[model samples]
Target chain A: MLNNSITAAMADIATAVKRYSLVGMLGWQDVRQRYRRSAVGPFWLTISMGVMIGTIGLVFGQIFNSPMKEFLPFLAAGMILWSFISTCVLEGCSSLIAAESIIKQLPIPLFVHILRTIWRNTLILAHNIVIFPLVLLAVQKPLGLEALWSIPGFALLVLNLAWISLILSLLCARYRDLPQIIASVLQIAFYLTPIMWLPSLLPGRAGTYLLDLNPIYHLLQIVRAPLLGQDVSTVSWCVAGGMALFGWCIAIIIYGLYKRRIAYWL
Target chain B: MACIEFNNACVDFPIYNASARSLKKRLIQVATGGKISSNEQGRVIVRALEDLTFSLNDGDRVGLLGHNGAGKSTLLRLLSGVYAPSAGTASISGEVASLIDISLGIDPEASGRENIFMRGILLGMTKSDIAEKLEEIIEFSELGDFIDMPVRTYSSGMHLRLAFAVSTTIRPEILIMDEWLSVGDEGFKHKAEARMNELVEATSILVIASHSRDLVLHTCNRVIWLEHGKIKMDSDPETVTRAYFGH
Candidate 1:
């Protein structure tokens, strides 16, 4: 019985993944529709992100007594990645529920909605990523081979985020307060994950064990370190990789048990 | 071969409150009564469908007849595989398309041509399939000049024309509809009806729910009468409709 459920859930995921055109088009339309009437359109995402990163970078650089050259690039990578991560998590929570019209009226795999959530946010990330390069140029950081590593790092980060978001979407669908609870949790996570402050600032054990313990720290490190031209610890890679595998297993099990119930839950 | 086999299929709808959803009224409010009871965990459960055992095959055109809360739509959703039965099983073979809302994925901000693709994708058509039918869908809607314009700019009749054209453009193995779809102004409605008929005729199996007695008697070979989620009667359309409408 358990095996059958898992296989069925896997089938759902597989079908959703194969329908990339639908997911991609729907996601693209989501981004387009939201910014349709605006003059600059989705560039607004780029603009706001630039403004937020700039103000935060200068303010925090002054407070931490860090040099602007290194600090701005660091802040850019961290903030841009954080935007993608947080949007996916927040929107993914409501992905299935927001699709109530389609859910009830048509027969579709539930994961497709979540994929749309991730895909649209990824497009927004594409807009926001423009700043990372400009910040690096401003810092005069020579583009190096390590910077290309962020490609794979971003892929892994997306994989990890997908699993957690999938789990959270199911929970949020069943428990109405879960989205609110998760939003608050992410707000705290945004502060604690070292996007604004340097992980090295914690000093000694705080930097060593505490940063290691937070999976977000490792996830941020793998991609952010690559973009900032810093060496990502082997430990960060392993932790992020392990978290994806482990979280997906749990997500798959929960999905198998509750996937069918989602239509009813909404 | 298109086939659907159901063995004692049952559906239980748990009506949750502020814990699972906000206190806003439900969007799927059908006229249900008496079956709203609590379970062991004290969750209010509505028995939407109970112990339904039936089978449908190719060439079947079954009409669902019921009052507002008699579970007709629920049965259509169950048949379309949207809501899995809470117990037992319904194994349906062949592709199923549910026309519960034909314009389900249509974006008002998008051009009518783009909405064809959007609604087509939502209907489970491949991108290539939608592209291939793009011209046909636009021509059928008679919206030559407006096809490139956003759907929001279209008149109400034109909107329905676009929706109806895109939705019926695909002929699935099994077709599920909430009602006999007839749209557009008087003149265009004839063409729309003809298109709807052609699509319905091409399907191997069809299940449509309706309150119209004449539409059922004229279109369906068999009729199932539902009352409070239970099958009260199932027989030939003539027998069932006569009994249902008290004619």
Candidate 2:
């Protein structure tokens, strides 16, 4: 009986999903909803990143004796990757809670909420991509066919984010304070990560370990490394791949155990 | 083609103390050798539906009558595949359209035209399907100039008119409705009711829950009276309604 019901539910979800080009529209809606009624729309994200990069590059480059041209592109890449990582973790915290209305009322697939979160953040990430071109052109940075690798790099980032969003959603639904803790932890991670500071600049063993322990740093490495036309390390792929597997495995377990109770939880 | 069967369905929910949003509080209580009394925990296990079993064939106009929390909504949720039963199985065939919490998927900040896509997506309609029905939904809603306005700016009537129009546009094999609440003004009510009546005619199977005896008598040929998460009486509408009213 349970098997039959599970199969039926799966079929229903498939049908619901097939009816709409959910990926296409959901991504658009997520972007539009966030920037609604705003003058610049998503360009605001690009503009702000641009301003931060310019200020930090000019002021800090002079202080650190690093060339402003080299520092500007680095800063732009850092800011964009930081935004992507922060958005994935922060939004993962409320992926379920934010959709409480739909969750409580409709019988749609729970995964749709996670998809919505990833798609929403992906939109911002796309906008942030605009800065790379501007920075590259301004700095006269090396750009070639290797830069196109960012497309696949970002695809991996999004896939990994999907796993993270799903697992975090299940956890936050069970634990209310998780979202706040996650948000606070992400704030700390931003500093721990080599966002404003270069990794080589970190003094010693302790700092290197801290950088190594932080997953967001690796995520940024995969993205920024490819965008900078550098070869991505195997370490980045291994860490991201491991986290994705671990997250998705745990999510499936939790989903299987509590799939029946999720509705009542809402 | 629309057939629905529920067999000894049960839904069991855990009773977690969500009031204090911290594990430390719960852990402290646990370490202190059960600070929270067992009686307090009984308030947590909610059996929304228990051992429910039923089947409906095509063209079954079944009205479900129950007081709030009597498993009426749970039954509808189960039938609609929203909430799976904790035990037993529900075998359903054909397309199901549930009208539970009408206007649920509409975004308040989006225009009526945008909401058409939002609500339609939630209701399992493709983008092309929403586009196809856009004109008919707009016409039936009669919100002429206001269709382009944000839903937040719409009156309660306008909200219902558009929601009902969009929801009823697709004729599902099974149409399930929770108690239809009032959405708009008097004239709007007439138009909405007419649309609902047409929807009823178009659907092959209809399930509704309401407290109103008149509504049950008028719209349903069969009725099930539920009490305390159990079926109190199940029979023809006139018979059950009469028994319920004690007339």
True-contact fraction in model 2 equals: 0.45
Candidate 2 C-alpha lDDT tens digits along B75-101: 888888778788888888888888887
Q: Which candidate is the best by lDDT?
A: 1
What is candidate 2's CAPRI-style docking category based on DockQ? medium
Tens digit of lDDT per residue, candidate 1, span A144-244? Answer: 88888988998999899889889988988877777887899999999888899987788887776559788889998889897777898999999999999
- The pairs that clash in candidate 1 are none
User: Per-residue lDDT tens digits of candidate 1, residues B163-214?
Assistant: 9998998889999999999998888888987888899899999999999998
DockQ of 1: 0.54
Candidate lDDT values, in order:
0.89, 0.78
How well does candidate 2 score on lDDT at residue A172? 79
A57: Cα error in model 2, Å = 3.3
Fnat, 2 decimals, each candidate: 0.76, 0.45
Q: DockQ for every model, please.
A: 0.54, 0.53
Which window of 10 residues has the lowest lDDT sum in candidate 1 chain A?
A203-212
Residue A159, candidate 1: how far off, in angstroms? Answer: 0.9
| Candidate 2 global lDDT | 0.78
